[model samples]
Target: MTLSRRPAHRDVPETAPVAGPIRVDPRTKNLTKRLTAGDIAVINHEDLDQVSAQALVACRPSAVVNAAASISGAYPNLGPQILLEAGIPLLDRAGEALMTQVTEGVDGSVVGNEVVVDGVVLAEGTRLDMPTVLEAMEAARGNVSQQISSFARNTMEYVKNEQDLLLDGIDLPELRTPMEGRYALVVVRGYHYKEDLQTLRPFIREAKPVLIGVDGGADALVELGYRPDLIVGDMDSVSDATLVSGAEVVVHAYRDGRAPGLDRVESLGVEDPIVLAATGTSEDVAMLLADGLGCELIVAVGTHATLIEFLDKGRQGMASTFLTRLRVGGKLVDAKGVSLLYRSRISGAALVWLLIAGLLAVVAALAATPGGRTLYQVLAVRWDDFWAFVGGIFG
Candidate 1:
């Protein structure tokens, strides 16, 4: 669900030009963390995937200027279509020079089809509309067969290299938080994660699953008022505040034992953070960590939100994700599926219990009042007299 993918509502008109301070980043995920409403995003992403696209949409950027082709026709990438649907104008293939020429935090404008910086026109690019995106998607679909072949080969290659994940699980850090035979919810800040997590509030409450946040996903849990028990990732995106929020941190290190995320967490005063050196994406490691630790049910939020997205992320990391899913498939349920199958609605048994509790409360309150004692005496006298009259008639 790279749900790193998304859909959002925007107030700006599609045809109108947008202006604001520009934010520059080659990494879309990092850019999202700092983006403010109305800021123009200057990115170097090529064949922009759904996850990165959705992230940009969430920041409510005025416009996105890509230094590379947003749709290279390599695959039917969903990013451009989502941006246009949200009414955020996309200036595609503005060229690599755009990254060097424009400085961050400078005033910029997306006028007509060109980028204007301080009244100087830096570059013009293809303004993607819905029709154009649709055409590109259709054409890209034709190349899926070729991509499928390449994807399989790449996945097998990784499966050989990272076989340790399958045959023998990597050594997981000892934890104070219990995950054994319990439901574990792993959150990623991807595709409709906010909406999906909102819907799963009931499940979270009743199940009381161990909350695991993967990198930036920890911020999402905090936003929803759920403190994460274990935070896992390269430590690039999770906030300093969240890192120090008493949750045990697991720094995802390279197989070679280099952990860049460790210094940041330690500097923030997080004590005794465990380092798990593993190959593959942080999200993959997060899933394996839960399953290997004996979690009975591992529900995923914003991680492969849907099957299409799962297939769409057919890059190098997808190979690891594929193997990790195979190992955890029995317990792994997508977050959206969990929300739909069950809701927070009260059961009949619960209603009956509530009714009984209410009646007991009323009796206790009435018995405590002085006037209630007088009423009770009168009722008792009337009950005795009425019973005597009925006994005489029966006799």
Candidate 2:
């Protein structure tokens, strides 16, 4: 009954699928006791996006608690979860302090089968009641305010000297602002964004925000039925259609003005339009573009702002993201958790079918052997007829 298992380790160089920002949970006990505000708590994995990371990092907890399972337990997540690489200590066991906070938050936030944000329970189990949910959301907003506030303040100060490293050899594209009072959705490559776009479609359809995709995110947006307004990045992971979607194209380049992406876009017949030469990651570029264009709100998708996520992308530090946050401070909104907001369950019928298929296979295999030879012979009076039936199925 045991299924064949693949070895946990493989020698071959396999192409791993790109996933969204790594999510890690804090596992330290007595968080209130062990951690202080402005402590620089590098969360192991919170499934947070760039803005959230910035907000959390801004809190500046006393020390980072890398509760991310990978660093703590080698449990795989989307990317290498952040805390360990951020010069933060990795906590293996969920200590009393951390769990106490999570429990208190959950209890104080919930009533009966419902989760209460403020005094209202948003949902009972899986069904959402928006009124209650909204109340909870409002309450939850300020729960992490101190952290976010500190992160913003600290990052702004930290990046002042590192601006050149962030802006090094990068191009700043000339952005054309066609609409006012509109928001911009900046897409970056990250976890389940493609699948989550199904849920995001309604938001896009309703908000009608200007869509901007960075590199592979350009293709991701297209896959999710969104025609990007402006595709920005090095053109490394985008498609030709995304580049030529008639939206303003901005190529993020090094400070040297020598963009590797420029040549590819040109070869694709995309003429010289606009390219922003900067020294940061494309997500950073996208945020700056949104800011420069005066977008009222910038909702980010799959963007990485954590030191771990930046490091996992092979960058040594988070200097660029740190600076970008200061530039787009209040207007930024991270849509990273939009994916984990829903719960899906297997249907009863599906379970029934699975059980039936498994039983049928076992019965067939058993009947084929000496275990049920007499029964098999009794069922197979005519071998030719059985063979014909099998052949007919193939036909």
Candidate 3:
């Protein structure tokens, strides 16, 4: 054995970087399900909406690195601004390489404007500070007209083919939950859904509408200490715990008989789930189900009601939503953004007037009774004494 082998060099152990673990997800909503505090969120989202932004803020991530543009100059997307406002560092336009290369649970650090993974610089991006987000928003605002035109054209095109399906109504399976002639509260995890749900606390207490959760809305209901009576959606965002919480499940599938969520429902041990193969968004399906099932009134929360909100979602499927609203018609009352508008059904002034009217009525009734004159003298004497006592203290 001739030559002596050289001693092998000892490899130094890599030190752990002072940063949070990175969680990579193309779908922000899905990532949020597992995201925890002080984690780094790497999302592949373009034109991030307000709802998504709020969800991220709730998780309180250390930083956010986006493979795609968070704003994208696509109609003043609010997500980037929200993240910045929440003090979460946002690195935008880091490209696809970062997403493909960085595995979940890797240590991620933000030094200046670069995203370093395990001490290696994975990507560099524009740090979205408040000013940057505002400027981007302003530019995005200018493109609103173009976006609107595109939305309209897309809606018209889709309606030509999907109109029949929407009008025909869903052939819903018989469910244990009753809906005829009762108010239905259909929730979607859309814009400010939590706030809207909280504002409707009194109404929910009084009406006791059938709690219908669309996808993640099921989780939303559970968060607010209410169990959904019916869970409807593609089953992507709905949690397993909520699925098995004794609520009737309605699996929303594609109109062409392709039901991806069905497999998930079955896998979760949810038996007897009604598979409704219908078109449009899950929220639309929920509303249509309520309307078709003879729900007297359907109150929608966290749905795309405003024009700006519709555009913000940046989905072509909004055409279905537009038609679904028309289909639901007068019975549909959108409670999205309701927290901004609703302070009280009865105003303070009105309540004061009502109190005065009642007091006057009571006084008049009491004065008209027998022994009323004697009682009135006694009250007048007491009232004078009370005022005299008060005056004595001051004077």
Candidate 4:
């Protein structure tokens, strides 16, 4: 079945009680998944890579089962982690079929962590409701299995550049944790981030922490309400206007100790110190800034977090991402789909207004064109046939 183009749960309350718990088992088929009024089936494959965070939010599932190595390799996405932290139970290392049993048993639980599933006992040792613990375990598994594969494949490629590895200028700065009580907004340019900045207006007016943007995000922040405190990345996505806006600039450099983006900054004659030469992508640098600046919370938006997302960008520098998260640990918050969570509740009048606007636009356009006039004429000729088909259905 096809879903509607618009989000179905747009009117759902931000924090509603999940309907009766659903039962699932990732391993077996004999086990039947339970269905409650609010229960939803979440399959974590690289599906997280294929869909937008907002799309997932629209489903409004009470919990999610992550089948993928969500916390593994060099990828660290802020979306799922944020969901977990927000009290959504995250179950990884479980297949869809097996997890169905777990969801079904959520309502009946006690004695240690064993969740009773269809008279079967699930140990607390395996099931998880906390985000941080689940993420770490998933990462450890991915690292042991995937990291070894990654090392073996890329080992020989760097044989010719042995000396290049010794360069100091290109080394990533030492990681630092964000300070207490301050929040940092890390921005990236993505679909609708510019328009979505309006959503941050409330947060900005209230929390007002350090504002840092990655490349184009700096420009985006400037367009919104707040001035950025720091700008990190290669400086390519950022604008001349943003560069001169007096924010501190940090340029990501090649692992070989080259400052590729420095010349661009100089061409613009930007006077602020551009910390050149760092490892990883710009988003990685933005995270590092939060860690290094001592900000209490790191709120990232429009940033890429999935394997597909990274592949889409054709990234070659995720090494820094893996290491950066290790430094920041648990304080990172990804606000990717916050807008969808707190979207303006569309009222009856507003939807009516939208329908009227759409109809008017179509009518006006049709009236303005001869092709449209011809199409309307054809429709008029077919009106009898159309009504006949409709009448025949009832008859």
Candidate 5:
């Protein structure tokens, strides 16, 4: 699944690129939520992270025009490679001024490196194909060691500041949803989350785990027809529709007790959302909440656990995640690993089909017997008489 990191300076097709309505957003995550297939995605995300790239690819856009560098060489980001590999056209570093030139839902086409509107070129930048993206990625990989060192330093500093999480169970707000002695399924809208969730369908149905969604993960659950038992996050990414979906809200605030998300929740008419002023990410808070509530087993889907994943998430450190996992211990399971090991038993539909086959075999055996012939004749006469009586009553 590794993409080749070499620039392909191949010839561009003579045919004009497909025209579509453009959707613009400075935040790639929020843009992806509204973007549909064939729409041109305009984003200002620099060093476009892998998770955001994957989200955009899933939407199947015709092209992506980034206002910032897709691969700024900050640290071998995989987003540009992912987009190029998916056969989507990418125009990199188109500049922030391009945002004002095009309105939302305005028809536009990607002509090579240029974004064309009604036969006029609005903006043009580097046209990234496979070879170019791959070459950039290869160069970026060399800087990964430096990034790792910085990440480690950040993690250590964070641990020093937030030691209470590791030693003592920090005081947390009370949750209305009970999680004790039950399986808590925490979902995040991160890497390969949609596929992982689909794979865990049987486990979700049978175990009936308490569904706890972190921010936009709540919207993901609702999209898949599962009601979230509890929704915890900073509240910036989640839609108002999800806030009103009856899930108990827990707003993650700053260590100094400033809750930016609290105002948004209040504006949405969500009354008395439990405001948790924590130092770490909302994901960390969710895990700690589950662990504190005495969940028997915690299954996590779409969570960022790896060093690269954290880096991709724009997180400088993973202090809280490391401590949270230590606290949860062996009780925690990754949804992808669970999917590989779990063997689905016979479904109800299969059992019904088997039952029908067995009944047919029995009927064939009975038909071959003389006593069965007499029984069939009696039943047939009774059936005809019943039908005649019903018909006569209707007449």
Candidate 6:
């Protein structure tokens, strides 16, 4: 059965909810890839961020049944709002039993705020509408100052733990690709990444920057027809195909040198993949790696740079990112900002069409005025005479 597009916020009245097949996954990212239109997405994601929410919205799911709290009121997360704005019915905090009771691919119905299967209520939760979401966002915003204070404290504590990142570009793992004095492109799968990459296409073509992908960002780069020169992350989100795709893999380990993701890399038959134990996010590690290798410029795509963006990722601290950016200094450029600043040149066909339009305008003006017509006739005769002389000489 086909489902009609959900009406806008104003149009949607108080009524029974739409029904569809249920697709369940704890991870929002994994669920996004498998979700189809008219399906109900059952996810266990807590405090859903805007990026994941946007991904879920792209799938056009009829409804979302979250096993965990969609918004824990941590810091005004944007995911729930995005989903509600897109007119997707969200039943937040549906409980773990819903995941167990609601079988995948089964005909599930969202009647009001409850998940019903085979005439039985499997789970019931609060239906997140616009007003509720907005109110929550306002409350979350009020708590932001507290979160910021906490974040600052965490950053200071982290500085004490990881001062090496600032003092000396901490020890980096040896890699096959050389990065010294070269341009580097580090991609993280966050915040309008697809659009940013689309805008950076010309830059990518011109500079051919050393492509570095953090975990699933490698898959994103591969999807965009660019092979990653280095893949650095915990290896949880990236696929096996990407691991074997010839990118030099770097497993981001804990400060104590525990490389959990290295086992996955080894299982994939990647030869001599390096492990860099660090006290920061993988994206931070990737930047430090490039900077340590003396990269002249570093372009960051989809990497979180803003305070809210960092908070959206559920980060209580930005110490490593703070230090990494300071160390890289002038070399680091955010792709979103770069895309906004970079103007694309007009295409050849577009320029040709513009020239043709200008000529037509000139011809019309010549036809409109007697003096212009006389001048045009004189120019036509002179142009023909000049071409005739050239033709005679050439022929």
- Which candidate has the top score in TM-score? 1
Per-model TM-score versus the true fold:
0.83, 0.46, 0.82, 0.42, 0.82, 0.82
C-alpha lDDT values of all predictions = 0.85, 0.54, 0.84, 0.55, 0.84, 0.84
Cα lDDT of model 3 by residue, 237-314, tens digit: 988999999899999988788889998889888879998888888998999999989899898889887777898766
For model 6, how does the per-residue alpha-carbon lDDT over 80-181 read when each residue is reduced to its tens digit?
989988989898888876666668899977777667777676776788888988888888888889888887888788778778778887687778999988
| Candidate 1 lDDT tens digits, 139-189 | 988887777777789889988887878777678788888899899999987
Worst 10 residues of 2 by lDDT: 15-24
Model 5: ten consecutive residues of lowest lDDT: 1-10
Steric overlap count per candidate: 9, 45, 0, 23, 7, 0
Between prediction 1 and prediction 3, the one with superior TM-score is 1
Q: Which regions of candidate 3 are displaced past 4 Å?
A: 1-18, 336-395
lDDT of 5 at 20: 94
In candidate 1, what residue range of length 10 has the lowest lDDT sum? 1-10
Best-fitting candidate, scored by lDDT: 1
lDDT of 4 by residue, 319-387 (tens): 445445555657776675554555568899999999999999999999799999999899987997899
Q: How accurate is candidate 3 locally (lDDT)?
A: 0.84
- In candidate 5, which residue ranges exceed 4 Å CA deviation? 1-15, 117-122, 345-395
- Cα deviation of 68, candidate 2, in Å: 22
In model 3, the worst 10-residue window by lDDT is 1-10
Candidate 5's residue-wise lDDT over 1-395, tens digit each?
11122232245655347579999999998898899999999999989888899999999999999988999886778898889889888888887888877789999887776777776667777888788888887888888888778777877887788778877755767788888899999998888887788888888888889999999889888889988999999988888999999999999888898999898999888867998887678887888888888898889999988767876766443666766787777788999888876656789999999999999999999899999999999999999999999999999
Candidate 1 structure lDDT: 0.85
